[model samples]
Structures are given as C-alpha cells and as structure tokens.
Target chain A: MVNHSKKSINQYAGYIYLLPGLAWIFFVFAIPIIQLIGMSIRQGPVGQEILGFDNFIFTFRDPLFIKAITNNIKLLVIVPILIILSLIFSTFLYERIKGWQIYQTIIFIPVILAVAAMGIVFSQILQLKGLLNETLRVLRLNFLIQDWLGNQGLALGSVVGVIVWKELGFGTILFLARLMSVDKELYEAARIDGASGFQLMIHITIPQLIHIIEFYAVLLIVTAFSFVFDYILILTNGGPNNQTIVGEFFVYKYGFIYNRFNIASSVAIVYLLVGIVLMILRYQIVKRIDS
Target chain B: MKKIALSRIMKQIIMITMVVIALVPIYYVFVTMFKSPDEYLFNKWGLPLELSLENFKRLMEGETIFRWLINSLIISGFSVLISILVASMMGFAIARFDFPGKSALFVAVTSLLVLSPAVLVIPLFKSMVKLGLINTYYSAIIIYTGIMLPISTYLLTNFFKSIHNDIIDAALIDGCSLFQIYYRIMIPLSMPAIVTAALTNWLYVWNEILIGLIFLQSDKMRTLMPGLSLFKGKYTTNIPLTMAGVAVAIIPTFVIYLMGQRYFVKGLTEGAVK
Candidate 1:
C-alpha cells in the first residue's frame, strides 16, 4: 500500500516536471496555431465576419502565389543536385583524398555562416561589375557574364546557385559522417572480389548510405520549401519582377508587408499541412533507419 | 597504376576547385571590409594595398551596431538557458519516469521538430502584439525558446535515455528523489548532449532573422543578422561599409562555431542520422 502511494506520487512528480515546458509550448505554439486557424477563415487582417474558405480562395487565385509555388517547385531541382554533389564530395573524403581533412574543414565554413550575411557577400560578388564579372572578363569569357541578380530570367537560377554553394557543405558533412560509420568489411569483401572503385561505389556504398540519403533528401526538400526566405529577402528582396519569390517569402509578404493577415494565415495553413506531411514522412524514415 | 594516379589527381583538382568556390566570397567579405570605397571600386578582387580600419571605425562610430550585438547576446543567451532548463527537466520526466500522456508528449515534440516557425509567424506576431511583447527582447526570446524547446527536449531525452537505467534505479534505491537523480546523475552525465543542444539553440537563435526581424523591429532591439540585413539595404552604395557590417555580424558566430564545431555537428545530425 505504501509502494502504491509512492508510485502515484512519482507519477505526479513527473507531471510537475513537465508542467513548465508544456505550459510554454501550449501558450507559445498551440495557442498561436489555433489563433492562426481562426484568422485564416476571417476576411481582412482585422476583419471579423465568418467568411469560410474565402481567404484561401483568394490566396489560391493570386498570381504571385502561383509564381511563388512554381518557384518553390523549381527550386526542388536543388535536392537531386545536392544529393549528387554531396555524395560525390563525401565519397572523395571517404576515400581519404589528398588534403581531405583541409577540404572537409573549409567546405563546412559556408554551412556555419549566416545565410543573410552570405547573401550580402554574394550580392556584391554577383553584381554586374562585381568580382565574378571581373574574373569572367579577365578570362575573356565575357559572354558568360550577365546581370546575375538583376535580370528576371537569371535571378532565380542565381538564387539556386547561391543556395547550392552554401548548403552543399552541410550535405557533404552529413553524408561523410554516415560514410565513416559503414562496415569496412563489406568494402574489403568487395575489393577481394575485384570490384572496381566505381562498381564498389554503385553496389556497396550507395546501398549502405541509402538511409542517410533519404533523410538528407527529405530535409533538403523541406529546406527548399520553407528555408529560402532569407536568401530571397537578402539577395533579391523578391525583386526582378518577383522572380525569386518563394512560399515562405510569399507568406511574409502578405502578413507583414501587405498587412493581409487573413490571407497569409490561409497560405500558412496550406504550408502547415504540407509541413505536417513532410514531418510524418521524415519520422517514418527515421523510425525505419533506427529499426 | 597510371590510370589510378590520373584519377587521384583528377579528384584532387575537382575538390580544390570546389574549395575555391566555397571560400572566395567569404574571402571577399573579409578583404573588402578593409578597403576604402575607391579601393573597393578599383581593387574588387585583390587584397587592400594597405589595411584600413576606416570602415570599421565608421561602423563603430554609430552606437546601433553595439546595441544590436548586445541584444543578440541577451536574447540568444537567455533563450538557450531557459530552453536548457525547461527542456532538461521535461526530458528527465519523459525519459526516466512512468507517466500518463508520455508517449503523446514525445510524439508531439518529435513532430514539431520539423514544423517551421515561418508557417505560424503571422498569428504568432499578432499574439506577440497582444501580449505587448512586440519590439521587446522577450518577444524573440520567448518564441525562440518555444521553437527550440521541442528539439532540445528531444535531444536531451534521447541522451538521457541512453544513460544506463541502472544508475537511476540504483539512485532510487538509495532514496534519491527524481529531481536529485536528475541533477546528480543526468545533468553531469549528459554534459556533451546538453552542450550540443545549447550550441545548436544558440546558433539557431543567433542566425535566425525572420523572428527577430518581425518581433524586435525597434532599432535598439534588433539583433545582428536582421540588423546587418537592414544595414545592407541602406548602405548598398557603400560596399566597404556594408561589408564591414557583414563582417561584424558573421565573425562572432564563426568564432563560436569554430570553437564548438564538434557539438554543432553532433547536435545537427544526432537524431536525424543516428
């Protein structure tokens, strides 16, 4: 009887421990999300009439929204590119290339940097008279030089280039970390069987690192969708006729820039659903990886 | 043997080219910050003929830069501290205790780990305004702590669970309370993971621009990244001066990251990769 009461007391103590964290989460996350839902169904930023689905309809019909979603999808191209580059670079490091340690350390410098600051740096470099153009001109490759961030046709592509440069470090390190853990015996066995480097990579390395690849790929996709705002805001400010506008930037524009809270919340609800789905996919993949 | 040597050299070349690409802009930022406007215009691609502190001097002459740095330190330091305290306690409970809704709470945290705060910014902003927290340090600190808590708890809980249950069980037999077991056994044992979580949160809170941009819009209240980003816009014509601001903004985080990179990488890849 004493033990039973003690068990209850411990259970209550567990609640006591969780109370502060849970309270903060409830107030900060849960309440705002609930309020987000309520605002999405209303009319204006401060409008009050129950106009169910209207804000969502307006958001869907907006051309800028269509452009933003299209740009986000276009940026999805970066995922496969990132995976490929990261795989190749990490494989080089995994093979212990000359100066691999130096390369690894320098490669990750961009990943640790503030994207906003890097965007400022890139803004200077990609300017028409900037270092990139200067170098191209000196190389007698002036044909390759264009107004990288100023031109509508090339702005999104330029943004993608910058994103790849900054984000590649992270993917390389992630893949390298996983590669470092693979069973060496598997590779030794493959080598004794006369498997060439390329063949071993295709057969052994790819299969061994598939789970990390999936984890990293899904993460890159999520990044492409929601994490491009800083790049947009800092690099182009969604300019060149809004060519570089993305989903998160779209939401930012409506909510903060235009004071269209209702519409922004509606778009956010869409993104929230998408984010939840991606989170579920990620969780399942993580579970599979663990098991 | 000749073919293998060729391929090896080719790999070195490829890697070297990528390294240059990765580093040139960072090199540019540091180099340009020391150049005068005329020198910047003339020598866009080389070291300054002479080291000049004029740009930095001009930047420091304004008090806003110092204010922004202090604000960043306060918000990031405070949020990471609160997040560690609250998250460690919650992780202790979830990892070490038998309780109702435990699985539910765990699931909620893991799920929210992937939920970007960008999606909820509008309503969060409104709520912050309602709480009279707009333009105050608390606005960003509270939200940053909230956003970081789930991941922090997730990391700490996993770390705490990996601690042998035998230790806690033995402590319980010795009549140590759960709180006692937590501090005496968990915190000290989980130092690496806690530092990893703390560094991760610090990096996130420090580099985060969107939350700070909206929540702490007042000039005196702005943090480093957002302040520099705004500074970039106003001084776009003054490249050297702007680069100086960028330098100031990125250097602190860069130094910290270099010092604590092990924790940073571990924190980043902990749950995801492992």
Candidate 2:
C-alpha cells in the first residue's frame, strides 16, 4: 500500500515539475506567436479592431521587401562555397597537418565574438582609410581598395564577407569532429590503392559528412535569413542606400523605428514562412543527395 | 624521408599563412586597446610605444559600462539558474516517467528549436509592453529562460535518458526517493552534460543582443552587447577607448573558451543535438 501510494505521488509530482517550463513556453513562445498572427492581420494598429490580410498584401507590395528578399537570397549563395572551403580546411587538419590545433583555435575564436562586437572592429579595419586600404597603399595595390561598407555597390558584400569570415570555422569544426571518428583503415586502404589526399577526401570523407552537411545546410539557411540583423544593424545599418536590409532588419525598422507594428508583424510572419520553406527545400535536396 | 620532410615544410608554411590571416584582426584589436591615441594615429602598425591603461580608465570613469556589465552578469546568472532548475526537472520527467503529454511536449520543444525568436521580435515586444515589463531585469531574465529552456531541456532529457535504466531501477528498489535519485545518481553521473549545457546557455545569454536591445530600453538596465553598440556609436572617434571596451567585452568569453577549450572544440557538435 505504501509503495503504490509513493509511486502514485511521484507520478503526480511530474506535472508539478513541468508547470514552470510549460507556462514559460506558453507565455513566451506559444501565446506571442498566436498574437503575432492575429496582430499581423488587423487593419490598423496592433491590439486594434478589425481583421484582414491587407497588411500582408501591403507587405508584398513594397520594393524594399523585394530588395530584402534579394539581399537574403544573396546571403544563401555564400553557404555552399564556405562549407566547401571549411570541408577542405577540415580535411587538411584531419590529416594532421602541422600545428593544426593552432589553426583551430585561431579560426574558432571569431565564432565566439558576437556579430555586433566584430562588426564594430571590422568596420574600422575595412574603412576607406583604414588598415586594409592603408596596407594596400603601402603594397602599391591601391586600385584593389574600395569603400567597403560605405559604397552602395559593396555594402551588402562587405557584410556578407564579415559573416562568412566568422561562420567558416564552425563548419570546419563540425566536419573535423565527424572526420575524427572515421576509421583510419579506410584512409590507409585508399592510400594503398594509390589514392591521393584529395581522392581520399572525395571518396571517403565527403560521403561521411552527408548527414552533418544536411543539418548544417538547414542551420546555415535559417541563420542566413534571420541572423544577419545584428551584422546589418552595426556595420551598415542597412544603409549605403538601404542596400542591405534583410527581413529581420526590415521588421525592426518598420515596427520599432517607424511604429508600423501591423506591417512589421506581417513581415515577421512572412520571414518565418520563407525561412521554413528554405529549410524544407534544403532538407529535401540534402535528403536526395544523402540517399 | 626527404620527400616527406619537404612536404611537411610546405604544409607548415600554408598553415602558418592561414593562421596569420585568421589571427590578425584579433591581434589588431588587442594591440589597439593598449595603444595611446597618439600611437594609434602615428605608428598604427607597430607595437605601442607606451603600454597605457588610459582608455580603460576613461571607459571605467563612465558609469554606463559598469552598469551594463553588471546587468549582463545578473541576467546571465538568473537565466542559467532558472533554466537548469526548471529544465532539468522537466527533462527528468519527460525522460524517466510515463506522462500524458510527454510525446507532445517533446515534439513541441524540438520544433521550437528551429524558430529563433528573431522572427517574432515585434510580437514579443508588444507582449512585454502589455505586461509592463519593458524595462525590468525580471522580464529579460524570464524571457531568456523561456527562450533557452527548450535547448536546455532537450540536452538534459537526452542526458538523463542516456543513463543506465538499471541503475535507477536499482536505486528505486533500495528505497531512493524520486528527487533523491535525480540528485544522487543521475546528476552526479551527468555532470559533464550539465556543465556543457550550462556553459553553452551562459554564452548564448551573454552574446544575445536583439532582445536586450528591444526590451531593456533604459541605459541602466540594458545588457552588454547593446550597450557596447551604443558605446561604439558615441565614441567612434575615440578608437582606442572603444577598442578597450571591445577587449573587455571579449575577455570573459575568451577565458571561458580557454578553460573549456576541449569541450568547445570537440563537444559543440555533440551539444548540437538536432
């Protein structure tokens, strides 16, 4: 009798244990999300009366919205290139290339620096008269220098460059982790068959990373859409002619800066939708490649 | 042997060049912080002529940096505590017991990981305003906890489930209470996972800016990154001073990374449960 009662009490205690986290999830995520949908459709201010899809209609109407979408699309192109680069780097590291631990530490350090903090430092370093240009002048390659963050033509590219620099090592580390676990005999057997390092990587290493690549692709695409906000906010503030505004930044500017909550909420929803679509599409492509 | 030696040299050279490229910005930032403004202007490339703390002193004399730092420390500590406490319990229940909403909750938590709160910034802001928590520490703390709980709970539940069920069964037969089983056996066994989860959460809370920028509107309550952003804006001309702030900002995380270097480099992927 005592033992059964004790077990029953503990089972009921599980609900009590769950209450705080459930309540938090409810208030912070679930409720605000529903409210977000409701607020996005309202014809007027947030919390105001009436409902329609006019806000979303106006969302599709804006040229900046298109620009934002293109800007985000521009970010996606960097993912595959950077991932490949990181993969190559990881291969070299895995081969036990000299002092690769140093390289790992050096490369991975930037990943910890918040985007805003790094943006401030890099803005100064890449300025027209900053370190890069000054070095270019010293080397008599001044023609290679251009206004990085200040030029409308170059602003988005500059932001993307900084992002790529920060993000590359993460993929390297991820690939390196998986590569470390591969049986050494596979590499040795390939070597005995006269396979070079590059061949071994292609036949042995890259195939092993398919799952991680899929996961990484989904992560990168999602981050590429939503995570560029702080970088844009700090480096260019979506300027050099507002040429770099992505969805998150657009949501910020319209909602908080301009007091257009209805519009911002709709943009938020659209960004959410586009992000999901991108993730799904990436997953499918990865899945096909994976099989 | 000679051919191998030559290849090794070439490899070292390539690796060294890449390391220099990677480390230069960090080295430059650290170097600039110690340089006087005059050194920054005149001999920007070389080592500082005089090691000076003038910029740091100037930075410290201003109260904003200290306020922001304290605010950050407080919020990070608060969120990590709440997250571990609530998250561990929930994770334990979901992992160990037969609950009514167990599968539903697991799916919900896992799906929540995909949605970074960056998507719903506007609605979240409105929600905070309605609660009149626009500028409170508790608001930011609770928000951080809520956002982080999914990752925390996911990590802990996985950790808990990985424990040998026979061990728990043995404990239960020996008359160990439900709570005692968690603290005595499971927690002690899973210290590594808890440390990993806690460290990752701490870093996330510390580095987070978007919500802090929105919710903590006042200077006194604002966290470090947003404060750091505003600090850069106001003192853009004072390059060394801003560099000092940047150096200070990166130090804690850098030190933590060093202390937990193995976990950071090797364990991050394991931590990426999804």
Candidate 3:
C-alpha cells in the first residue's frame, strides 16, 4: 500500500515535470496548427470572411501553383540522383580509398555554408562575365558562354545544379555512416565464394542500406517540399518567368510578398497534407522493404 | 583481377573530382573577396596580384552585418538555453516515471518532427504579428525553442534512457528529492548528450533564415544569412564587397563545424536508430 502511494506520487511528479514543455508546445505548435485552419478559411480582399474555402479553391486553380508542383516533382528527380551518387561514393570510402578521410572532410565543407551564401557566390560564378563563362572564353570555347541563370530554360537547371552540388556530400556522409555498421565478414565470405565486387555490391551492400535509403529519401522529399524555398528565393527568386517556382516559395511570395495571407495559409495546408501522405507512404513502403 | 584494379583507379578519380567540385566555390568565395573591382571585372579567373582586406573593410564600414551577427548570437543563445532546460526536464519525466499518457505524449512529440518551421511559416508569422512579436529578438528566440523542442527532447529522451535507473533509485534512497536529483545528478551525468543536443541546436538556430526573414524584416533585426543574401543584391556589381559579406556569414559557422562536426553528424543522423 505504501509502495503504491509512492508510485502514484512519482507519476504525479512526472506530470509536473512535463508541464513547461507541454505548455510551450501547446502555445507555439498546437495553436498555430489550429490557427492555420482559421487563416485558410478567411476570405475577401484582406481575408475578412470567416467561413469559406475560397482561398483553397483559388490556390488549387492558380496556374502558378500547378507549375510549382511540377517543378517540385522535377526537383525530386535529384533525390534518386543524390542517392545513387551517395551510394557509389560511400562504397569507395567503405573500401578505404587512399586519403578517403581527407576527401570526406573536404567534401563536407560545402554542406556547412548557408544555401543563401552558396547561392550568391554561385550566381556570381555563373554570370555572363563570371568565371564559368570566362573560363570557357579563355579556353577559346565561347559557345558555352550562354546565359546560365539568365536564360529561361537554363535558369531552373542552374539552380538545381547548385542545389545538387551543395547537397551531394550530405547524402554521401549519411551513407558512409551507414556503411560503418555493416559487418566485414559478410564481404569476405562473399569474396571467398567467388563473388565479383560488382555482384557483391548488388547482392549485399545495397540491400543492407535499404533502411538508410528510405530514411534518406524521406529527408530528400521533405527538402523537396520545403527547403527549395530558400534555394529558389536566393538563386533565382522563382525567376525567368516563374519557371522555378515551388510550393513553399509560392506560400512565401503570397503570404509576405503579395500579402495574400489566406492564400498562403491555404498553400501551406496543402503542402503539409502532401508531406504527411508522403511520410505515410514512405513508412509503409520501407516497412515492407525492410521486412 | 584486372577489372578490379581498373575500377579502383576510376573510384579514386571520381572521389578526387567530387572533392574538387565541393571545394572550388568555397575557394572562389575567398579568392573573390580579395580582388580589385578592375580585376573583378577584367580578370575573373586568376588570383589577385596583392591580397586585400579592403572589401571586408568597406563591408564592415557599410553594412549592418555586425548587428545581424549580434542578433543571431542573442537569439540562438537564448533558444539553446531554453530548449535544453525544457527538453531535459521532459526527458527526465518520460524516461524515469510511469506516467499516464506517456506513450501518447511520445507519439505526439515524434510526429511533431515531421512538422518543420517551413510548414508552420504562414500561421506562425501571422500569429507572431498578431501578438506584436514581429521585429523582436524574443519572437525568434521563443519560436526557435518551440520548433527545436521536439528533436531536442527526442535526443535527450533517448540519452536519458541510457542512464541506469539504479542511479536515480540510489539518489532517492539517499534523500535527494526529484528536483535535486534532476539538477544535481541527471544533468551532470548527461553532459555529453546535453552538449551534443546544444551543439545541434546551435547549428540549427544560428543558421535558420526563413523565420528571421519574416519576423525580423527591419535591418537592425536581420540575421547573418539573409543579410548576406541581400548584400549580394545591394552590391551586385561589387564582387569583393559582396564576397566579403559571404565570408563573414560563413566563417564562424565554419569554425564551429570544424570543432563540433562529429556531434553534428551523430546528432543529425541520430534518428536512424529508431
């Protein structure tokens, strides 16, 4: 009876300990999620109405929104590219290439800088008179000196290239971390069985990395959904006629820039819905893959 | 055997090429920070004849980067402190005691990981504005603590579990009250984990831009990342000055990264265990 009383007291103390954190989460996260619904339903010029899905209707109907979604899908193409690239490079590091540690350290330097800073410098380098074109000119190959970010078709591609460059090493490091845990005996056993390195990689290494790949892919998807905002904002500002627009940036453009607060809120809701669905799908697929 | 030898050489080349691709822009950022405008315009490729700090001088003289840096330090510092306190307490609660709703609370917190500041941008902004928190250091600091809390708690909870329960049980028998055990026993015992969480928080709150962009729109309130970005627009033609801002923005982070990179990779990749 005394022990039961003491256990209850500890439980009570536990609730007391959770109070501050729960309160903060409630105020900051819970309230905002609720407020998002309020903001989305608001309509009229300054979102004066209290009860319509007009903004939601308009958000879906907007052509820019459509373009942004497609552009986001296009950007996700980089995820598979990143994963494949990361897997290949991490395999080399796993085999202990000469100076692999130095290469690993050097490769992650780009990952530390703000995308904004990286974008600004990349812009300077890709300018018509910038190093890229200038180097081309000096090589007596002026034909390659076309407007990189200035050209409409090329602007999105250029921004994507910079994103891939800055991001590639992070995925590589993640895969390397995964590689460290794999038992070495498996590799030796495969080798003793006359398995070629290529076949060993195919049958053993890649399968062992399924969970990390799933985890990495979810991160890439979230990045696709949200992080592209900053990259697009800095590098192109959704420019060369909005060809590079993505959902998060579109929300920023409308919410803060255009002051379409209701519309922005609507877009954010749609974005999170997509994210939750993607997460659910990823979870289901990865469980099956893992099992 | 021959194929294996050839592939080894090819792998080395690819790795070397990756290193070069990763580093050239960073190298260029430093290189361009020294060039004279005439050299910037005419000679875009080669190293400067004489290295110059003039661009940094002019930038320091002209921009509000100092103010931005101070602002970031203040906000990130405050956020880190508050997040650690809240997370540690909550982690202790969840880790040590059998509480009602403990599983539900854990699930809720875990789910919150998927909801980044990006998803919350619009409502969060409008709510901050409604509360008259726009343009205040307190605004960003408070929001940062809340946004970062889930991850901080997740890490701390996992860490606190690794602490043997007997330590707490022994402390209790020795007449250490729960609060005393937390402050005196738990925190000191979990120093490495706390430091990892703190370092991870610093990397995030120091580097977050979108919240700063919205809440701290005025120049005096701007943080380093956005300031550097806008500095490029303001000095588009002046390569040295612009690059100086980029260098300033990245230098401290670079130093911190060098010092605490292991914690960062471990803390960031920490979720893989679950």
Candidate 3 lDDT over residue span B64-180, tens digit each: 888898888898999999999998999999988886688678757755766646568777787787889999997898889998888889888888888987888788778888899
Q: Write the per-residue lDDT of candidate 2 for residues A112-220, one digit (tens) a residue.
A: 7777777888898889988888989999997899999999998888887888888877888888888888899998899889887678878988888777877777778
Best by the lDDT measure = 1
How well is each residue in A59-84 modelled by candidate 1, as lDDT tens digits? 78888888988998899989999999
Arrange candidates by lDDT, highest first: which order?
Answer: 1, 3, 2
Which scores better on TM-score, 2 or 3? 3
TM-score of each: 0.97, 0.93, 0.94
Better of 1 and 3 by lDDT: 1
DockQ for every model, please: 0.67, 0.52, 0.57
Worst 10 residues of 1 chain B by lDDT: B265-274
Model 3 scores a C-alpha lDDT of 0.81
C-alpha RMSD values across all candidates: 1.8, 2.9, 2.4
C-alpha lDDT of residue B121 in model 1: 87
